[model samples]
Target: DEEGQPVAAHIPGLPEGAAITEGEVNIDLIPTHKLIWDFRIGDLRKLGWIIQCDRKSAEWVRDRYGEEAYKKLSGKFGGTRTDGETEFEVNILDSLNSVLYEGVGDKQRVVTPTMRSNDDVQLDADKMIDYYEYWHKPTKSNPTGTFGIMLADQIMEYTPYPIDSYPHGELPYIPANPISVQGSTMGGVVRISQARPIQREINRLNSQIDENCDVMGNAIIMVQRGAKVRHSTLDNGAGNLLEYDGKGEFRP
Candidate 1:
């Protein structure tokens, strides 16, 4: 149940007619050890340790930005018809490319002979091949802020594609095992290395428990050190009796 309450089910063979009390159903919960080796599976799930892939481009944009932002962008930059499926059409890639290459033709791509490097290897930056930069600044009215896909010198309000804040406070990246640190958006740490010591201890304890159980599981008998008792008698008939006569104490 959403509230974590157990919902009762009435089986076909049950006495209740499509409505059974909680007591009527038997809930047999298997032990965690019997089901899985790692008890931290639940914790890992809660921490978002699962594989996922997002193939939908439109939904991806909608998820990062708000629905209004997606609609605005979709209208500003029309989607391409994908195999006659206009409803599922997406132009996110085209929009991004267009934004990145806003003033590509305006920028001077061919460098003069003097501007060329000594090694005759002219880099893209040296040729003045500039691309539009994406900017977003938060305001009191719009907490998500306004988006601007234009040149570095261009102002947010002056951009042609003016959209509101990314209401969905999520970055355009797959969220995995992430660690949070103050004054940092993303932090890195070796999770396996961090858990190595604890895992080693758990393994050692489990090994010790198994060894102890194996040794202690067998029946132990105590008798006089000098006493004589037939070892074969233990496996003999149920009523068979074995007597020890000596005085010194012994343990097996």
Candidate 2:
């Protein structure tokens, strides 16, 4: 048996938690290595890929802290929770919240929350030019806000980047990105289709406030008649005319 030879063996006992039927043999198993390889490294990669906790991050945590901290870091990110078991990737949402929201647990405040209101979503689109400029800060397109560029480069890289392994949080798209729209002015090209009702309501409220102000204005004024007029009827309302604004001028 020690001599090199092709010896048939029952499926190398299926790896832990494998779904193969018991008593299976590698010889009898369907050949799927090729298909599996394709799935792992093929067109389907667009759907997503694996995100691993990097050695740099692990080493940084460990060196700054200790084995205890390293263990926690690894355990959470892809390290051993137990003696020989470690996770290899961290949660996407938690990572995003920590970086983008400054560690705010309140999901509503998330820069890219799972659920965004029409106004919030529109705001992102409205700031496309600013986003592009900021990310490419100090450039012709963006003459300020280096932080945006720094953050996108550091944490929010997409597609080939590890964050692309995630399928959610589509808000991180910014200026100079493929999704961004080029314009003479600012604003992204995100087409919002459901904000009309809200806009109408806002306009209605403003109109009502304007109307109320008009009524209040009319109510504050008293009709005037010259005091020199023999038949002046306004003197009867002098007390009413005295009602004026802080400048002592008749408000009406």
Poorly placed runs, candidate 1 (over 4 Å):
1-67, 70-193, 215-252
Report the lDDT tens digits of candidate 1 across residue range 183-222: 6532343334346689999999989977775665644454
Pairs of residues clashing in candidate 1: 225-248
Kindly report which residue pairs in candidate 2 clash with one another: 11-25, 11-26, 74-79, 78-87, 78-88, 79-86, 80-85, 80-86, 133-142
Where does the lowest 10-residue lDDT sum fall in candidate 2? Answer: 128-137
CA lDDT, candidate 1, residue 108: 40
- Cα lDDT tens digits for candidate 2, 1-252: 112111123235546445434464432211111011224433321212122222233444445456774443332332212111212122234345434543556553456544322443342212211001111112223222122211112332222222222122111221132233455322222222124467889999989977765655532234333433322253332223423344555555
My TM-score estimates for the predictions, one after another, are 0.17, 0.16
lDDT: which candidate is best? 1
